[model samples]
Target: MNPRLPEFQTATATDEQKTILNEILSGPRGNLNGPFLGWIFSPQLAQHAQRLGAFCRYQTGLPLRLSELAILVTAARWRAQAEWHIHYPIAMQAGLPADIAEAIRVGAEPTFAEQDEALIYAFATELYETKRVSDATYQQAVGRFGHTVVVNLVGLLGYYALVAMTLNVFDMRADGQNSLPFAE
Candidate 1:
């Protein structure tokens, strides 16, 4: 499937877009792909999303393993091929076992050895499935991760959900590959 939005061109970009593009290129991300390609159409949105994304992905109090798990949960829920394809290796490298990821991909309940993994999976899955977390889940999250981390976890999941939507709507695939990670 062709992407709904074509790649942005620096040569034809307005001054505002050029500045945003330059920041994205020079920033930690160092590339204009994924949602950035769609966001570049509106430079202000691109700028805010870029900064928020950096904070959510890097500055969050949640550990990388947990955050990546949240992202994968969002990807699986959204059936976002690009997000899963990009982060699967990162999640594995961060110590998430292959079986857990495979379970998520196949829409099965994962058996998590670590309590933290189980907690995050439950938190994310419940939120996505129910649109509101039960009081018990919220308290469990706060007790385990504290208030700050709980907030960050919500923001990170929200951001990745947006990323998943952008990828799905645009039919964006990583590296020009054309295969669905989760069966529809």
Candidate 2:
């Protein structure tokens, strides 16, 4: 069944609102959840908020590939089709191997480099299944990945996990496909 779209009272956008909406559109466009987003005019406040969130994901300085792995695990936890559809490729482009991406997408144990693969999967699974991470898990992550990567990995999981939920709420759709690193 088609998802129920949000029904809201429409009002003419004020100059301030328009400015905020435009800002939101500037970067981190976020997923466009269906045609319904057409209603959200870009505004400065929204843009700034989105930008800040994006910036925070980088606060840890983890390599981009690790960040994407964390995000992929989070996406699977949510079973957010659209979210996975969007990010699977981004993860690959960031250096995630195609086989690993598929394994994660299909919910299998992927062949990954020893510490890197297991660490991300364990963290992601715990977060998804339990909604919280264990201290031992955190310690392992920090021990292997270092402080910065460990923090960023967790943050990235939360960030994309939230993004997946938001996309579901809005019924977001993937824009289009290009060559993703994970493609067969």
What shift in Å separates residue 173 of candidate 2 from its native position after superposition? 0.8
Candidate 2, residues 55-101, lDDT tens digits: the string is 64456576667777777777666666666776676778888898887
lDDT of 1: 0.89
Worst 10 residues of 2 by lDDT: 30-39
Candidate lDDT scores, in order, read 0.89, 0.64
- The TM-score measured for candidate 1 stands at 0.95
- lDDT tens digits by residue: candidate 1, 1-184: 6778876677898999988888989988787656887888989999999899989988888889989999999999999998998888889999899999999988999999999999999999999999989999999999999999999999999999999998899878876556779775
TM-score of each: 0.95, 0.72
> Which residue ranges in model 2 land beyond 4 Å of their true spot?
1-3, 6-12, 28-49, 56-59, 146-149, 177-184
Off by over 4 Å in 1: 176-178
- What is the total number of backbone clashes in candidate 2? 11
RMSD of each: 1.3, 5.1
